[model samples]
Target chain A: MNSQPPAASTETSYGEAIRAGFVHLLSSHREVFAIGQGLWSPWYVGNSMTDLDKLFGKARVIDTPVSELACTGAAVGAALCGYRPIVIHPRMDFMVLAADQIINQAAKWHHMLGGQAIAPVTIRAIINRGGEQGAQHSQALHAWFAHIPGLRVVMPSSVADARDLLVASVLCDDPVLYIDDRWLYERKAVLPAVSERPLAAEGPRVVRSGTDITLVGAGYSSWLCEQAAEILAAEGLDAEVIDVRVLNPFDPAVILASVSRTGRLCVVDGGWRNAGWAGEVIASVAEALDPRQLKSSPRRITLPNAPAPTSRMLEADYYIDAGHVAAAARTMLAARETAS
Target chain B: MSHRHWQSELAGLADPAQYTAPLVIEAAQGTRLMGLLRSMLVIRHTEDQIGQLVVAGLARTPCHLGIGQEAVAVGVATQLRTTDRVFGNHRSHAHFLALGGTPTSLIAEVLGKASGTSRGMGGSMHLFGREFGFHGSVPIVGATIPIATGAALAAKLDGGDSVAVAFFGDGATEEGVFHESMNLAAVHDLPVLFVCENNLFSSHLDIELRQPSDRISRYAEAHRVRSLTVDGNDLLAVEAAANALITGIRQGAGPALLEAVTYRFRGHVGPNEDIDVGVHRRMADVSAWKRRCPIKRLSEGLLAAGIVSGDELAALEREVVAKITDAVTLARRADYPDPSALHDLVYACRP
Candidate 1:
């Protein structure tokens, strides 16, 4: 069991890494660019997208006119015309405004055209930060995108992984959903190297390893699980924490491999609990592995079905903190120990 | 004299006794116009065949056939090119055919065969032809209009002379996005053309019953877009409107509107003109529309001009029927999409 994470994978916060990576890609490729409402503005909202406009030029580092729907449609149009636009929706909450462009157009165009047209557009959506932004802003809607068939949904938790995943997403020949939360961007880590041959790269790259228990996490929650693993490791628990960077085309091979050995799994997604991405992962794991392989039942930690709370106090009270994640992992391990 | 050969209801629209002006067949327009006429005829015939197929339980798709609305597509597409982007609504057979998509693929898609435009997945509603600049024709009423506007903005940004066209029905105007799109296109001066087929019935309710005024061009005027109103069944009128608007767009003029005042012989939903009609548009109105057949009018004018003899016109009709028959047969025999194709097309198959 390769319990120890490689030093190469360790880096700065997921946010900084993603921004640095985007700046690098935008600088290297002219056709590639970043566009959003606060992307290249004087007041940069998505932390990773700061200073991108100055480095990449105004044409590439575009600032939209507070129109999510228009910009997304423009991005799709630009992509169809051969320009790879890395459109930033900034907040997952605003994606509802762009639903027509996302669902009816972007996701269905290639198939509608009988695969003659492939929109190589990448949208970076900030999601599930568990902030005081309330129902309007704080949302983990990765599952919404994951449910869509044509889009490649990505959720990067760590800085280095954020850069790697986003760079990889841009190279994809189809539309990709590169989502990282507002809170996750400021969280720094080491930078990871990029895959040069992205065309051959299919989906979800596993960034962490474990044997005793699988801690499946993505976006900010992945980091939460990693922090939780440290607290559990001190108590002599060998928990395998897997950062589910790519959410939509979830890598079953890596996930199943980790779960097969561990025999215990816990999916921690910041999305709403009832039918969040955690449910999808849990369901998929159960379907893929035989019942006998399980030493303990898989579990999940997610947001309650209610709308995100409004006040900062309520937000802090409701956040799925590292302590909550550790306790969940501890409970899983205890359950397995009891079963055995 | 315009030979009034319309169905019983449409006979009064024009006087058969008086001479109706020739639709004309100039030296340059003969070959291309003939091709356009044949394309519209193919669409009309395919829908008729699909109507039968639906009854025979061969096809399960709910096809919105624009049989009487052929002139709109043929007329507008005559001015379009491989570079211009086009978006269509649920009834987009002529839209696809006008942009040069194969009749076989159209029939194959409607038949839910793998040889379909959408590989049998999207059926009748969703069709696309990007290589030929037919972006997509979706079922969502006014969804693609804004997309076309965005595409027009992109063309302008890229410094391309290409224009984007949105082919939607009068019902689609009710969508908020349609107004927003027109406003954006006009203010941005994007090279986009809005072609509204005001067939007067959105699903069942008449345009008059819905809007305060019967003229949808009023909305275009509200957006400050240069507008044109024409008889949709007149192929020459459609062509003239399309040519003028397309030319204006390519010349860097902002978005323009061309509203073709026409009527569909069929019902709102399918090949049958009988179902889904409101209490207002009577059988008499549909029968009256028969006198305004764009194909018949053009053929009569051509026959009178000696540009085409009666035998030549007959030969053309026979050729169209034979071609459509062949396309249908080929489409029917074509393969269905493999299951593996289902997963691959959704995401970017980078390899």
Candidate 2:
């Protein structure tokens, strides 16, 4: 944890920053088009597509019918034919309907066709959770998209990344799955300007530096780690927070280096507990670090392997937040204390 | 209940040799009948050579032969230019040759040579030749229908008269992408031509068992798109249907569907036509269908129209045979790719 208190930033939330990013992207590239259902209506409140259809007209900001498979396939086809299309799946669960086009066609075209084509399309699939919505609506399926080889999966944890990563994903010359979590939309932070160009390829960034423990988080989980870092700081327990923005081409050098120093790690993610993206990160650190490097065993804070419940209390207990992350770090510290 | 109606409506097209009447070309000069004849002949000879390779154990891949259905490809390809995008499915040998793809490259691809269309990575099922405007082909049925629609949308965005064509089988119509693509094309008024080759059987299972009807144009009609069902064996009919559709598509009228009723001469895959797994195709049906060969029909038409005599037809066959023989020899001699190149073509050359 830092010696000084964190500085106060602007009041713009991640959702607002993301919407401005869309306006910038649409105005920047004439070939770029954003197509999905309910984009122009209030149903897409945090969609970052406010007034895009009016500004760019219906042709550019295409309002498609309720067809995920056809629309996703159309985006892939459009990308192949020299168009940069950002296809939005307002809810990530419905993206399963388009698995054929996403996994088989969009992801495989470049490699299977022997580089004869480039599907430079960006799929903006949102992970909406925390509500009383039932099983169908509240699921984080980023791990499945990360499992594919030809795709670049990015989970933005901060408002800056939400803006910059969208810009980067659209500019990338390959199929990119830009996974956004709705929980982080209300979190406010300083973001890049709409016209500012960010790095095309960014690795994991160490947001908060510490030495006692290395806390890893992806998307909303990264924000959770930041909150946990504050709690750990109050207890005089220094904890390092690393935001894993890119999941597919994950370079664990930073995590391994932090683990080598801290000798303990806690992975926080919004995915299933068993066989999740957090597990992959934890396993990588365990494999890369020596056995003696760890003062205590690694820990993972993820959702239980069950469908989301409709009750408010059940929803509260199911999701992992800042308090859960801090508790996980404390448990690791207690175990090390007991052993010592 | 609709099943019975579908059966009666499709009963007229159930026979394999429904339109086996030999074509007698009346006037061949102004219509470019000679080029059409040559194109069909090339496709027939190409598939024939591929069958020989599969039987000789030289081609080590699934060679889906469209031996009896060459006219469907040649007809559609005749009306297409180098800029018009076209996609094909597993049974795409005739589609490749008809689009002016050289025999040497295609045969080399089948033989897994380094100089093949996919650089030996995609055997016979996956083919890619952008120069000739055959964008790409995959083994997955109906996979390219939406992709072709995307290409057509791209053409429209580019503000050009170019159109996109998707060549698939009757089996592909059963896939959701086919219907989705038709709807998308119609909604966007994309310049796309959905060409369905209704060969009755979809890999040994008859269309009757799979669908309520044998005709695929009905699906197009459901999408409110213009469609035409033609005798796939007759080159003129297929071309005329495709020409009208392509012209309208170019004029920004919208998407159109052309269902070419044809039959595969050989089994679903490989050389032998007599061997089938389920509901064996009667030998009489196979023989009668062969009598309606696209190449033979065009040849007879050309001969009758005084375009070429019997001796000329025989000489053309000999010439095609010689070219195929040379392509095979070259393909056999072509080198296989180095093992280190396994990961090379997976991505484009990064700039």
Candidate 3:
């Protein structure tokens, strides 16, 4: 788990991690399959859909047309047909064009249809490096889905979590919004033999722990927070780190428990400030906590409310790095001193 | 209920009338009979209003009004129950209302009011009344057909007899999923009724211009499923076909197709039938098609049969108009969904 991209195998950059989980999903469920835009169209721009075409064959691993709306509608079609489909979100932006399918149809069909229709569809969205990709390409917009009721949002930070969540997603009865971080694509680790069912496929999991400030993060930011926590421990502040595997059905009890124990909180999120997932987490922590729980006001470190710049120099200026997260935690602690 | 023939369900795509043109019905009688008429009328008026509403700027969503297409819904839905599932396409007002969904909720939905069928989030095209067994309707043509077919497969797994229905237009036949849905539904012996309202148009392009034959039954025939084509304007015909075929399906007759040939008086979308896309449209054909109005034709037969007098028919019209008016008022007065609720519906609620 370094900055070096893992050797690209016969699989595409995104495919190395996806291959294991998708293969597991296919073998386990007679009804489950992986499908999406480039599913057969030859090029998987963001999804590591390499060798998938070979594994599942053309019928199951379908590559569709440029019609995102039609493609999404087809997913609903496939899903309603008792097929558990892992739908490709191609880009964070493509979903916007197909909102009617996901937001209006697939997401609400079960509840709206009075449980008569269950859309057990999984959407895989990739948030590539949010900084250099500019406005559209760089968004870690799990916050866009942070409020839907019927969806389970899972953003895995490790290879096993990545692989296991895919299998678990296929197994779950509800629809899942599974986000893969392109920034971490080709990043490798030893995957656990992913259980078909583990308790937290759509819930949070603690990656590492400490006793000072609890740092919660998801997807790419989860790894970033880990590095930031290391810097914090070196600074003599023991910050615990929690990987919020899921965003919407967020594990508030676990987060609050950590906050109750540590008596402080700092969140690092890749999505932009204001309306991002970090803001919601901050709100959730604030809403859940009373006067009894804290030694400091909770802090959130995220990309500033500005367009992602293309140049490396501008990215360093715009996006949040480990140094920024460590700085924010210290600032929260320092501000805690004045208030006390 | 014993269906030894166990016919292929999609054959109706080929032989349109075989499944829908039945002159036989048994022991059908009061609120149940009247309920059928009421549903047809409600479909007519609601769609008529939807046309006006779209032009009036009250409803912004694309509205596929099934105005001249009421009998098919009342006919098909009469044979269905709450436990059974039904799905429709862009033209689903009749499908939803006939299945016993509220007019106020539908109107509110068209108006984007909180009390709408989808809680004001999904407009007229995407109606979901899961409690009443109306699963959903999609704007994407033929999208929900396969889903309904799939749901039927699920119901089969659960055992016992429950049928799934997919109500689409002739235009949807062009989509590959329609055939896929039919093939899958038949091959699995899933108990589903594919009801196609062939009004001879895909939006503005007439089916004649788009298709080689005026008939859509051939596709259903190609699939080797049981097929029925009927004058969708005839309620008795629609009802008899649906009733007879539905019992067979529920008795494990497998999949079947009932193609009801009907027309929508309105445009491919919104209220105006000729919303300026006059390319292949003939006002004359629209007029000719209007004469085949399912409601009018039914009333004429009822009147000829002395089912009621002119005064009684007048009274019924008044009641339907009143209901439409009330629905409009309520929908207009109803609130828009909370902007916050926008985020709430996409996922299942969890603690």
Candidate 4:
């Protein structure tokens, strides 16, 4: 299913890379279709799916009614009938309305059918945060889905993965929850031609190399870790950055190796503190490694366990950014130095 | 205008004795009518065997018996093809059997054997008979309505005449997704038949207490889809309505609804008549509903039409009982799935 590789890489934003993925999949595959709310409207879904309906025809790129459960369940049914469909939920918070179809139906269909059937549907849930959206509008519930036994959760942190992971997800015969962050849409990179690969081959990658501390994150949190690594570099503390691309069926080999070498760990997560993806990452590392190997105890920078406040002033304290990650990394190093 | 109540118009139909008249058998329907009767008998006997299994403690799964609601499934299945997809709710044994699913596979599934339809992973609530056009069934009420709608969308996109069917109960209409699916199917003009087997009760709660109206086809009207309500105990009525609606759907007439106002002789979940659970249900209602059994009415019609003799009807019952007994014996002999391969099917292709 690999398309022809481009002769040279082209500069592309994260949002455009996603569009490129959709374009490539729709152009190449006949069975692929996209269905969801606001798929045709740029104001709702941003530049990611702009004019896709016009490009691929309204039949293939369906802009459905504002029924989350029905649309999601419809996409699943289409998938069962030999169609590869991508159901886009404009916001992760509202996607909760269709949690039954996603968690119970899509995820369990193959297993419950004893491998006789497959719901090869990709659910693209975008995390829209900040700008005083508050509470119901802002959430990153990737942990809840990653906890499911039958789901494959992918969070694309880099521009190349933004496009490539979307391609891999739709082509995959299993249901995948491909989460993208609105915060990382502006980040640009030179993306190569779409080189299709199995989703199983993708996992955590060491984006930056260092020896002092390891920064682990996925999606926007991975972007924060990259920014934090740059800040730590200026402060004479070299930090290794690991992007956990696939949250479900998470391969801790890369992160374990990075933390084993760096001797310190600080995870940056966009979700809440308790029972969060950050905690799962920490637990995975803790389960595999001995305590004596680390220079200091692991630290995690996450949102407070409270609903997002609407006030602009409180928003600054509510959301986790690069500065918080940098500060947390600095404190972890400082604590290790004091102990030594 | 003051709103007219459904209880008054529907009172005669639900009286149990009202629709006991034998079916008007046409010369052309002799073979077809007997086939329908055989299908309903198969479901009744198969579920009867399952009921016995539940009583004997051999069936550990939660078995929702559609004992008296067999006509709805058999009637609808007669109009469907192998290419036309069908989905069922929790009470789906009748649906499966009517769609040509073997009793052995279903019994094996309930017994947690390797030969089960779901390979013993899913019990009575979850079943898949893809060859018979049964996509699957789940215990979640109204969950498959949208799924069948989606399948209809697929059928439309595939440029085929095949339609999709969702068999749900009156209780499922209360779910928001059901309305959403109806609206979506109607809006898209998708070929889907929404079959509501209005069994008068959602679990232990009666339809009167659950919804303002006892008639469920009004929801279809709310979505602007063509609909018909029929006496579910009458096999011919359901068959005729399903035939018209399914034909219309296949001919690009978009979605339709068939509300078969039926009754389950058994309780909500198991084989027992749950008259003690709620104030609305009683021994009288159960006995009255039993008198209006779909199998009995159809058999009486066949006898009245001289299509079969009294000895033939008795002999047919014995034949069905023996076949079900053999299926159960074989299902019991089937081995259980290996515990070592518990995680074999977690994902189609594990990452």
Better of 3 and 4 by DockQ: 4
Deviation (Å) of A153 in candidate 4: 0.9
Question: How accurate locally is residue A52 in candidate 1, as Cα lDDT from 0 to 100?
Answer: 70
How accurate locally is residue A17 in candidate 4, as Cα lDDT from 0 to 100? 88
lDDT (CA) per prediction: 0.77, 0.83, 0.74, 0.90
Q: Candidate 1: TM-score?
A: 0.88
Q: What is the lDDT of residue B74 in candidate 1?
A: 87
What ranking emerges by TM-score with the best candidate at the front? 4, 2, 1, 3
How would the docking of model 4 be graded? Answer: medium
For candidate 3, write residues A313-333 as lDDT tens digits.
888787777888888888877
Deviation in Å, model 3, residue B233 alpha carbon:
3.7
Off by over 4 Å in 3: A1-15, A41-47, A130-132, A198-202, A291-293, A334-340, B1-68, B74-86, B89-135, B138-291, B295-351
Among the numbered candidates, top DockQ falls to 4
User: On residues B1-351, what C-alpha lDDT tens digit does candidate 4 reach at each position?
Assistant: 123443634657667767877777776677888878888888999999999999999998999999999999988998999999999889999999999999999999989888999888888999999999999999999999999999999999999799999999999999999999999999999999999999888898877777777778888888999999999999989989999999999999999999998899888877888542443458788888888888888888888888988999888889988999999999999999888546878777755
**Stretches of candidate 2 exceeding 4 Å from the true structure:** A1-9, A45-47, A194-200, B1-11, B277-279, B347-351
lDDT by residue (tens digit), candidate 4, A1-340: 1245444654688998898999999999989999998987877877798888888899999998889999999999999999999999999998999999999999998988777889999999999899899898888999889999889999999999999999999999999999999998889999876888999788999999999999999999999999999998998989999999999888999999988898898998888899999999999999899888888888888889999888999999889889889998999888877987
- Can you tell me the DockQ of model 4? 0.78
Candidate 2: give the clashing pairs.
Answer: none
Over the stretch A1-340, how does candidate 2's per-residue lDDT look in tens digits? 1124334554667876677667778888877888777788855747466777887888887877677887887788789888989999988988888888888888777776666788988999988886797798879998888888778789988888888888878877788899888888888876545544433347788999999999999999999999999998999889999999989766898899999999999999899987799899989998888899999889889899999988999998888879889999998988878888
TM-score of chain A in every predicted structure: 0.91, 0.94, 0.89, 0.96
